[model samples]
Target: MSFAADSPFKSISILYRKSHIWLNEGCIPCDLTAAQAIVIMIVCDFSTLTQDEITKRLSLDKSVIAKTVTKLEERGFLQRTTNPKDKRTYDIHPTEKAWQVYPHIREQVEACFCRMTQTMSEEDRQNFRRLLDTAARAALNQEE
Candidate 1:
């Protein structure tokens, strides 16, 4: 249940925080939080996606995403409007602000990610990413 100082998980966690902090600090002039940035990225790739859609995409629960999306909507970053085709469902739509900021934010984040990945061998990197995706899918497919 615990990790030593040099464990991969611990190092990765610290690196995650470092990268997140850098992203937040770099992306200014936008009323965006890192969480909101994540939502925007997901919605961009999966437009008109619903709360359940985001939850499934991010492997998070609906209530948590609902709360985050509510804040994003209130801040004018995203809109969780009712799906006109199916009023019973709602979908996430990005605002102009989100569209404008996405490219820069994604670039910065990708640069940081590249910096991290540079340490990995090409084969190991591909395998690691695939395995991570597999694990994520398995976790997401589990019963709620």
Candidate 2:
């Protein structure tokens, strides 16, 4: 069979799509879609963050983050209280339920990475990770 020419964009696109599918399936037990699971993981890591903080960190649209946060709050995975320092903004925090599923969410994330790099040697994995980080930073126009 003929192979397609090497293209980083094509490879990255495929990886992004496939990883999302894999993560979504893995998160099924937690009753979360991939997006919700990701929001939970971020909130759990920070303990408390404003919706704007989450949006900036994830580089997602504000409306999307707002909707996700609302859904998470309704489902008991998160709690939102008016930020004391800024009454107009809400501070998002993971609930006991979110903590309960934190490990599983982390496991799914780790498993996805492991599967993605399973074929690579340890050194190759390290190099690939480093290169990917650099590329990401460049794409974001961030200083190294």
Candidate 3:
């Protein structure tokens, strides 16, 4: 069967590809891969996140998050300290370098999102985001 324009899988795949390329180019100055940059941003926003939390939030494999965190720690972009509440887990925190460039990264992400939704009306944008969020939550919940 031929793929249709309305296919959710195809649309999500296309969005993922475009977002990857955009983030990769945007993260060059930070010496981070798109994935790592995303993790850093999440950690900065959350202040304290564990590797498992990142894996869940990003819908990525635990090993991938572990490797990305290792790289970030190596680059001094983040710190992974033992979690006081959970002896078996480590809490991730963005370091000074991450905090310094966070504003730029945040601005780029916001601008990119704005550009992507520029043609949509306010209500359309709201509905689009709401649907995506709901879909994401459902997908995540389905895995558990």
Candidate 3 whole-model C-alpha lDDT, 0 to 1: 0.85
What tens digits encode model 1's per-residue C-alpha lDDT throughout 1-144? 355456877867876797777667656546566666778888876666888888888877778899999898888878877888899998789888778888877887776666667879989878877886797688777855
Candidate 3's TM-score: 0.89
lDDT of each: 0.77, 0.90, 0.85
Q: For residues 1-144, what per-residue lDDT tens digits would candidate 3 score against the true structure? A: 556467968867877787778878887887777788888889999988989989999999888889999988998999989999889999999999999978878876766666667889999988988988898999999989
How would you order the candidates by TM-score, starting with the best? 2, 3, 1
Best model number under lDDT:
2
What local lDDT score does residue 24 receive in model 3, on the 0 to 100 scale? 80
> Backbone collision count in every prediction?
0, 0, 0
Which 10 successive residues of model 2 have the least lDDT summed? 1-10
**lDDT of model 2 at position 66:** 94
Off by over 4 Å in 3: 1-6
- Alpha carbon lDDT of residue 90, candidate 1? 84
Report each candidate's C-alpha RMSD, comma-separated, in the order given: 3.4, 2.3, 2.5
- Candidate 1, which segments miss by more than 4 Å at Cα? 1-12
Which pairs clash inside model 3?
A: none
Best by the TM-score measure: 2
Each model's TM-score?
A: 0.77, 0.90, 0.89
